[model samples]
Target chain A: MSRVSSKMALAVKCSDTFNADACMHCGVCTAVCPMGIEMLPRKLFRYVQIGLEDKVKENISTIYSCLLCGMCAENCPAEVNIADNVRFLRKYINENEFNLS
Target chain B: MPLPTKDILGILADNLNQRKSVLPISSAAATRWAKGLDLPKGGKTVLYTGHLYQLIPIIDAMSGQMAKFEDSALTKYFGLGRNVNKFINMTFFMGMMASKDEQKDYDRMLRNIALLLKKADVDFGYLYGEELYSGALVYDEGVDGSFAKHAQRVADMFKKNGVEKIITVDPHTTHTLRTVFPEFVKGFDIEVKSYLEVLAESGIEPTNQITDDLSLHDSCVYARHENVVEQPRALLAKTGAKVNEPRLCGKNTHCCGGPLESLFPSESHRIAGNRVEQLKEAGGSIATMCPICLVSLRKAAKGSVKVNDLSDTLAKAYGV
Candidate 1:
């Protein structure tokens, strides 16, 4: 089981704290993602919400792969801040999972 | 295990004689920027070299120290600092990993800016060893405690050095010092100006002839965040660089995939690839104002197109 650290919690919290509920769960962010990354935004937040730490761990590539381009956030029909959520996930991953040493 | 940032900054402080987080690539150039040039005699401008610019030189010198990292677990994770016998190869690999070219660019960029500012008659003094990293990256990385601590240290240094007005070279530094510092450090009231803004005010004329159709990429921080959209275009126009517009130009401009490069490299490359396509489609070589953008786009272009710092474009036209 993946540890339930504050990094994971804060990463999840960013979605709600940043008002990600405004997200309509549309596939536009995934469509606009230049890299064609599959995990996308809403799927990631949902993993965090459900405390699916292992699920997040499984998609570590997608988590670190986020470009934080803000294009998705800019085009969000519901005006959710997808970029900030990805950033929060990056912080969590860097601190908890990766070699940002 | 990740290497502690304290160790990173500590080694930097030891090698550089201060804790500033400037890259090691420009260490020599940074020293030379102020060498034999009398400060306090200038037009009261303290040029602040932000993080990622000004190579430390010590990092290369400390390559020998990496020998300890050979068998270390940290090396396995970060994927280097092993193979000490081939120090030469390892060093080059480290340079590539660290984006040494970008460091060199800032050093060169500084010299060109110094030449231009001299032409503008704006006397400027670099703080040299006294200036510290504004901790901009630390904050951006969400290391809140370190950022707060480092920000205080930076503020203290400014006060200790009696710095009043500063000319910053990058938008991130300019944004942090001008906007973010006030929020973090109470009574942190100091005037911060980007060199571009200062140059814009100077109205200096360009001497080099430019005939290339250049497409300028405005940085998100520089344009949308700071409203510095016109100054660079005005400077490029003054230099006679024929400008072309990309599909996403001005405030509506698209990302260059830089901000996430460190955390998400391959994905950032994809974004850079897309941005390059947009710029190439604009029918001109790219001119970038931000250092990160220059590095990212240059990598993505793979010599297929030229991507250069706006300073180089200006340097060709106005360099002394």
Candidate 2:
């Protein structure tokens, strides 16, 4: 599962606004979620960073279910834009899976 | 089973693209709250509701209906509903499900906000029916293309109305208009302030002594996104009320899960229930600054905690 796909690598490229690479596997985001969703800004971003597209796919609902309330971003030690990363993933899904503009 | 995210978001995106509101509502129903308020139309500064308070009851009714359909076979029809919605507005049926009393309660909050502004002698006008929804839902949901077009429309409407400054009633509207709009709409330069911020600046002294103990639920959008944490607290303090802080509050505030209401109703309710427990421990009537927070927390509170719009508390204190 650690085998990286150049395709997946391309998909998760760091942008000026979105940098999951800045995450340091901190569990603060998971602890702070109002829903107590565990695969949030921490595990999800870790998945993205490792090019685990299948893992990201399995948790698509978890991504959409986020309140985007900024709690995770506030508590993050690495100062990652956790909410924006979730949104970037959503946009990726919308464009790829749903074919939405 | 996974949720049909594509279908649900498709319906919302279609509605926004076609109807200009996430839910299709008549302009009369949208602007009915401002009736008899005699607000001057089109001014340099305006009270921009963003139709957030006005649309809450419909959102509640629509989401309540959708919640019933969540795990059922009827979920298949969401795609069909989206197709039909392109021509015929299915949300009208949903809008009819909204409780009149709930509508009145939310509308009363907006009225109280306006009255408080009046009491402060703040010079402002209203856009009335011309006001648009801030596209906060689509933006948050990452329906960027639809949101961008809708944002441009809202910005153009503001420019047409000569609105240099706007006093937004809720945090979602404030954050969207103030922060997100600039990115989507070129030259979007509207000065956006939440009513609480405006009131805090106005410094209207409380007339009636408020002795009620209040637990304040800070909106995540206000607290973290827009830096509006202190403004609401400051306004509440002016009422001579003792405001209790929940364990998770201020910049570290917990979400009410209102944002998930559209797609994940059951999970949304579960999260709201959890936040209500923490808020209830604060020991008093609960106050919320956002309509989404008011509705989400009130449903979880179930009359046991007495959730209220913060404006209502301020209305009583300032004798508005």
Give the number of the best model, judged by TM-score.
2
In the range B1-320, model 2's lDDT, one tens digit per residue, is 33478987888888899889887688887778877888888789899988889888989888777788888887777778778878988889877889999988888888999999999998899987788888998888888899999999999999998889999999999999999999889989889998899999988888998898988999999999999988877777767799999999999999998998888888888989999999989879899999999999999888888999998899999998
Per-residue lDDT of A37-94 in model 1, one digit per residue for the tens? 7678888777776667878777765665554555676567887777557656655655
> Candidate 2: where are CA atoms >4 Å away?
A1-8, B1-3
Per residue, candidate 1 scores C-alpha lDDT tens digits across B104-211 of: 555677777666777788877766755666776655654444565667888887777777888888878888888778977989988998889988899988887788
Against the native chain B, each candidate's TM-score is: 0.78, 0.98
* Candidate 1 CAPRI category: acceptable
Give all TM-scores, in the order shown: 0.74, 0.97
lDDT of 1: 0.65
Q: In order, what fnat does every candidate score?
A: 0.28, 0.87
